[model samples]
Target: MGSLSVLLKESWSFVERPDRLAENFYARMFLADPALRDLFPITMDVQRSRLLQAIVHAVQTVDDPEAFGAYLGALGRDHRKFHVLPEQYITVGRCLIAALREACSTQWTIAHEQAWQDAYAAISVKMITAAAADRDNPPYWHAEVVKHERRTPDIAVLTVRPLQPYPYRAGQYVSVECQYHPRLWRVFSIANAPRADGLMQFHVRAVGAGFVSSALVWKAKPGDMLRLGAPIGTMSLDRTSTRDVVCVAGGTGLAPLKSLIEELATFNRTRWVHLFFGVRSRADLYDLGALNQLAGRHSWLSVVPSLSEDPGAPGCEQGTAAEVVARRGPWQEHDFFVSGSPAMVRSTLSTLSVLGIPRQRIRYDTLTSTVTGA
Candidate 1:
């Protein structure tokens, strides 16, 4: 791990154009195995970015074996829907090394290649082991949309029923593939807890040029069928803990938080919950009514809607959700769940740290890829 980390750091200077590197990598991969090309989406733009990000993540976590192993396990589980085989990892590793060598040009060394090969072998073993262990589980769930409601111009709440039992914890997210855009998947959090009827709900906010989100929000009908990847995420409620919970959500990030809250309600957990839903304006606050109704029914739950743009809106607290949370003060004792865009989550996390909150008590799911087009 140490040698691989050193090699990665030393080779970082040679990566002048990651886009070109990814392009070369894919070209080499396809050249090696033409059949692999069919597994990828038609558009390689976002896929290139994802590849680069994955490489960076793997390199940075090399020293932390536990984190790296967990990442590989999750990757293996997620790639099951794509039908990735253990043998394919060898091809990918070869292409990756070839891309790095080509990118490095004259600077590429035998030591660097050896380090990468060793690192990739270790990664592949963990991934393959995890995938084999998960063979019994279904790769993906075939679901039919039973209800679709446009909550806002760009946001749609969908109710889908899986043909088979789809078991997932509250606050977990799943990759959704709509028929309109084949091979393209977007991640969305389930909005509700598991019900006896086997109904699953998702809240999707369409951003500019989001293929899956746009198709789901606009083109998808009641009878539309969608493919759901294995559920993945760690932002679930800590049921063993008896501490009060503080949930901070921005825009569509409210979906998972709502699920956690509903799960608590269903379990009759009496812990106090402070939920702060933030939006740019009053018009963007789509689920305020539902949240308010939940809060009204549960004495232990408090819903605070914060408007950063339309502060004067009735019942809306002025400033960002993090700002409002700061004003409330003394949040060190609460277990925190923060969700939103990457920026929002980071900002809230920083605020929590400043308030003397322990890192272990803070929970959030870091998105591996971009869901929104932005």
Candidate 2:
């Protein structure tokens, strides 16, 4: 395995364009098995990038069996929606090997082929084992949009009722598949705590090139049906402790943090919670009104809306959420929950570290096509 890792790392250097590598792999895959092509979206751009990213990640983590196995498991669970079968893994592996050989050309050797074969076999077994273990679970839940509100031009708040019981903890996110875009799915955090009626809420921000998000925010309407993947994430509240909590949310990242706060409100503890919601400008602050009302009702909670780029916002603090939290910190005693864009979360985590907060005290879930269960 050490030699296998080294070979892959060295061979990757010969492939100057990862996108071309992904393209070659997919092209060969579709040629070999035409039926597999239908499982993908019309636009292959994102899929290509994801393919290269997955391969790179797998190669990089091959030395860490536990992490690699978990990643493959999550990937397998996510692929259930595509109806991926164990046999398909063989096809993918063959195409992947061929692609690598073509990309590496003279650099490729029989030893490299043998190593990749072993690696792919191991990965496939792990993925198949995970999918088999999850056979009893529903691949996805069909939900009907009962309410859809465009809070801002690019942000939409949706309340959907699952056709069947969907159980998820606060701070978890689900991949949403809109009917308007059949094969495209995007991850969005559940914006509220669970309700007895099986109603789920999602807060979506339509990024410039976000196809699914654009459809959900701009075109989705009441009575439209959508599919929600099985709940997966690791940002839920730690019910074992009643520690003081500090939540730093940027943009739509507020969704999961708000859900966590709502869950805490139901508990009979005196632990204090401070929430700092950050946005680029005052106009981007969508949920401040509701957050303020919630804070007014809950004495244990405090909501601070911060403006990162706009300094003159009437009632908002001036700075990024991390910066604002830094000014107030030395929060060594508080459990921190940070969410939002990847950049925001990363920056906030750095700030927390600088303030002497232990890594174990921070909680966050990074969302992707396949949610990271870590």
Candidate 3:
């Protein structure tokens, strides 16, 4: 109702507690939109705490206002999972300011309200700008499936041709949506590099649940239309860096690493690469043929298989992938990328840290969502 610029300036001076801001935001969000209650777990308190912490972490890193805008934009994009709407933003904001007033008590005055409005506007402007930019310059994945091969049990390789070229830096993932089950979507990493033919490959596994995975495993055939999202995730190789690259994956986590390995084989032959892949048993090991080929072509790249159950499998090494990385020697020469279950990510990260791997050098991708069914 008041002048937006004046309110913003006034609010900036009145607000000090970032934690209180976050708490007010979440509290207001849930109060106005009670339907969103189901989106979080029964332990709403924990989720609220984590969300606030993550927001603070993202906001505190704003060296530049534009960077802050991008960060807020990413959060807005991610909020799509909850179907947050434009109207919801206002309600959420009102509730947040109310919560701040109640908590801050004496500090909760008209000036503080103005400052809160200003901060919200700053965040909102950046978020909107970022979202628009993302929509305009979307990631490329306009592909038609040309061939699908059942290479191994639980593993299938799909070769695709795109109407528009889908060039990607290896080690990023794309979300795929199938027509058979319209609403179902799953994320898979590209397994092939940008070959001359322009064909991209995805290595998918049948998890035996969900309409998408089951359809992919039993029903979906070549020539099917599969909508895809642009590549995402920060876990990718920077070829400029000379750091020895160490890749660790569990089960389907191999998808992204495969692309990285291929890319490494093509461009950077001199750089050292050590890939450790973990599987429950021999039955779960997929893409060995391609991995073997890569190893043969690039002497600098070594493939190590770690099977949990049957270490006796021919060519399979014993122990968990983390153990192999630890025992096969300390990782002084390599920077690590890990992807798998949260447990695996946590355990491997802990082990790597104790082994002297710098936290910054060890990157990982953990499933942030709770896996659900149709």
CA-RMSD of model 2: 3.5
> Which portions of model 1 miss their true places by more than 4 Å?
1-16, 59-67, 101-115, 368-374
Clashes of 2: 0
| Candidate 2: tens digits of C-alpha lDDT, residues 1-374 | 68889987887787877888999999999999999999898988877876776787788778877667866786677678888888999999999999998988998889888888898999899878887888887888899999998898888888999999888889877777899889876678888889888888888888867788888889999999999876656678888887899999998888889899989889836899999999999888988889999999999898889998888878889999999999996689889998887677778888888889998889876443332110
- Per-model TM against the reference: 0.91, 0.86, 0.71
Report RMSD (Å) for each prediction in the order shown.
Answer: 2.5, 3.5, 7.7
Candidate 2 residue pairs that clash: none
Better of 2 and 3 by TM-score: 2
Query: Pick by lDDT: which candidate is best?
Result: 1
Question: What TM-score number comes out for model 1?
Answer: 0.91
Q: Model 2 Cα displacement at 89 (Å)?
A: 1.4
Candidate lDDT values, in order: 0.86, 0.83, 0.66
